[model samples]
Target chain A: MSESYEATVTDPVSAPMTCDSNPVEEWLRMDRMPHIWCPGCGIGTSVNCFTRAIEESSLDRKNIAIVSGIGCTGRVAGYLLLDSFHTTHGRALPFATGLKLASPKTKVVVYSGDGDLFAIGGNHFIHAARRNLDMTVLCVNNFNYGMTGGQVAPTTPEFAIASTTPYGSVERPFNLPYLAQSCGAVYVARWTVYHVKQLQRSIREALEKPGFTFIEMVAPCPTLFVRRNRLGDGLAALESYEENAVIKNGADTRECDLGMGGPIVCGKFVDIDRPSYLSNQVAHLRKVLGDRYVMPDAWQGVVQ
Target chain B: MVETKKSAAPKAPKGHVVINTERCKGCGFCAQFCPTGVLAMSKGFNLKGYHPPIIADAAKCSGCGLCGMYCPDFAIYGVKNGRKPESGDL
Candidate 1:
């Protein structure tokens, strides 16, 4: 693990060389370093886990495509050095579904925020899970709409204060894991920013799952959510995760609804195998057409 | 005549972290998240007028890399003073 070199006069040869290469740089667009995320924001931490999972899985980097919708978490696709799509608001799941169907060999990942996924795109989320489409969806739940000011969202817990809910929200929030599991997601997991190792491990597992894998990542929105809720700075928010999170791996998703106060349940709740949409379609075509049917190559002509 | 001095491969340095002080945004995440409590915010300010973290105890560093994992900015990372592992080990 060493290279010998003969230094020339123009080499300056003033200082000893060291391995300055950073491990995180290889997976990122280094020129895009110093991302727009607020200081101490947890989205970047999730990005770290993502790159690590990609590396650990030993997948071909070129075949992985990242898709995102409009929001703070959506910026993940732009920062990664992969084939990424930043689609319209609340449309990441559908876009990813199309991409996955087009190129079955390519690994498609949809990463976006709660407001973008659960609020506006909830119908798409449920349908995609119901169809058991092959894709990984990572939702960063900051509990409110971070990009469009501190507005309340479908995932915002009841009684939590948002710019839109100054008097406290009377509406109940959706328990994402429960919703995903009920909608037929094959894999469901949740983790907070403080659980870095667990988050990374869950990403690795979700990447390996075959159909409709979903991970709910809770992060701190220092600028908007934190300020509006009177939650302390980003660091304090992580401290809160440490204090409030409870790991219950096999707990029923029905009882895991998170509230404004009390312990937040986090773990992998559902994992089971069933026929995926494309797989079932292929099976049906083979059974009906017999020798007449020929399987088409991924990314091949579908319109024809 | 040009003279070139050949130095033996540098010895493996001790495990320590180097902070890019200017890049820090005074988030205090490193100080709060360090498992060994080896980091603390310095009283001094960087050019950006933000307090940066400093190594409070060099002896406690095990190079666990939690600081780098939690840091939103790529301002901090772990430095290992050991032989590089074979390729494909990552």
Candidate 2:
């Protein structure tokens, strides 16, 4: 907490309610009201679910750290009243990994857009999940890169009209839950902003989960994605999600492939138990090193 | 997407919604998906020149807080009269 804006990002449960009427208002940086999210953009709604998820998760706010990379959804880190890291483009996972290693007690949540997470940061995403790090990755998939005038992103569905794909996208979009589940993530889920409560609950579940957890939030980008594709405005996109999204909890991730305006099989696709990376490494080291072992304190008593 | 299944509303008013017109972007998600049809788009516009949602039928609200959850601008929220279904969405 610095003198930059006389507000502290700590202990939500104990802090006095500045905006008693709206509970989520406490978690937001009120000074930054009327965020940059477009009029019909679903990012704001996604953020609402996130703040509510954090509250309902009942986790210690002081120990939770939010990390994000460059993009439209990447701006989420700056708006929330928390210890957040706005890292370089496609570097959010790396920063989050380092943060988790340095402060093992901290809950690292990497919240970024599809382009940031699945495009440039794609390698980091798989590797982090492969190691099963104790972290949560919330990827907002709006089908295309909205901020940069609707460029075709890694998650852009086939036959979609993006700026890069003028006629239609010929490339296949990434089935996010399948990627995370195959990479050994302990928990994986997908939900649209239309399913706000479900998305919030899924996020809370991911927060409480031990190993690597991945949740893809399907949000609509009205300014870029929606308008460019002629899918109507933000409300029309939400309506499509309402019409197409099917809730099938415990469904196979393989069947969750999304096409251009097709059935979106959404649910908790994967939930499996496995030893986390750090704890396993620590246990192995302690056994081999015997009495010579000493725990590493990278934060060096400054973070707490 | 889960709010479509409509059961009969309770006899008495369940909740009331508060709207901050200034921040509303007038996406109309709240009014369209309100399960009980509690809200409608206001004829007037905010400072941003976007029409905000107004509570049209106060008695029909079920305190589900779906409007608050669906609201992208954080401009409106429903306050339940008593305990609510699933609670926890302001």
Candidate 3:
């Protein structure tokens, strides 16, 4: 289907002269095309999957709100052309929870790095998942604090070297999918940057599913994490993930922990249905107040 | 475009690649993971001094956006010559 267009397009010669635009161009703020993430960082790849998922869902874009905490991944909110908020460190989940509560119809997404989600906001993460808030939480775990210059983080694998832990971190890292699963997340999945298609598909699935959905994206931190650990460049890091990652959909979350180097189990670990925080509240209020209860306009028919 | 179902040789998937050279940070992700080896890093550097991937063999392209999927910078994307938005039919 070669046409006359130059290097940028492959449109047919007889096809209508539609505007030349990349699929992602429409979703992003063009002015921020060159994001701050260093070359080979996995955050950009995750963003690609995210845009694709949003497009696939066919949801009203205006009704979706994205919130991010302070970190390299937090910059995503500024890049996407949507209602986004770059909240304080570790506060992204709470902000997203409030957003979901205020407007039940709006799709709230909390995207942040491991440091922000697990280190600073660990309590919020556990509480939100326990409450089964209706929101999607994407934790881009680079293993360390990338923005703070390669410091050790809560998700840094045990025995991994970081700036703060030159002799190797002794603390056991949090197994993200396991944590999410135990905390009562409705959906739990983990994927490295190499599993772009799977990550995108899971994000899409999480977006549509009600209640708390948690996705752990193991992206490369080329500038800090990779360089500090002598993990070659970003490409090498991604290649390592490709080589080591084992797809284990429906695997037990207990076995899905990452060591310094070994088989990296990646898949959708848990998917179960239950009453969401909002849905449960609405259901109980209606039963107690009977005819006197006034159901919120958005949740009128969503009692169950 | 002539409809050529001519079944003897399976029609190879066609793809269009749009590269923003200036936006590229010279990451070899697109070239390294192009499944079909349709791209290779160029010898010359962009203004940013990074060697962006150039189309090595355009004909081998299947229009799978894996290159775009792995790309850290929004420097490159592959578009399948589908009728319309069906290419990104994910």
DockQ of 3: 0.38
Report how far off residue A38 is in candidate 3 (Å): 0.2
Kindly list the per-residue Cα lDDT of model 1 for residues A1-304, writing each as its tens digit. 1111111111112222232344666778878766888776889888877887888886788989999999899899999999999999999999998888778888889999999998889999999999999889999999988878879999888998999989899999999999999999999999998898899889999998888999999998999878777888889888999999999997899998988766889999999997888888887988999999787777345212
Candidate 2, residues B21-54: lDDT per residue as tens digits?
A: 7788989999999999988787776677788777
TM-score of candidate 2 relative to the true fold? 0.89
Q: Of 1 and 2, which scores higher on DockQ?
A: 2
Q: Which prediction has more favorable lDDT, 1 or 3?
A: 3
CAPRI quality band, candidate 3: acceptable
Error of 3 at A272 (Å): 0.3
List TM-scores for all candidates, in order.
0.88, 0.89, 0.91
RMSD of 2: 8.1
All candidates in order of DockQ, best leading: 3, 2, 1
Colliding pairs, model 2 = A194-B1
lDDT rank, highest first? 2, 3, 1
| Best-matching candidate per DockQ | 3
Candidate 1: interface RMSD in Å?
A: 9.6
Model 3 agreement with the true structure over B1-90: per-residue lDDT tens digits: 989667987565576666777778977999999999988888777787787777777778887878877777777777666545343543
Q: Give the DockQ-based CAPRI class for model 2.
A: acceptable
DockQ of each: 0.19, 0.24, 0.38
Q: Tell me the tens digit of each residue's lDDT in model 2 across A1-304.
A: 1212112111123222322356567788888887988988999899999988888887899989999999999999998999998999999999999999988889999999999999999999999999999999999999888778899998999889999889999998999999999999999999999999899999999999999999999999998888988899999999999999999999989989999788998889888999898888777877999789777876435222
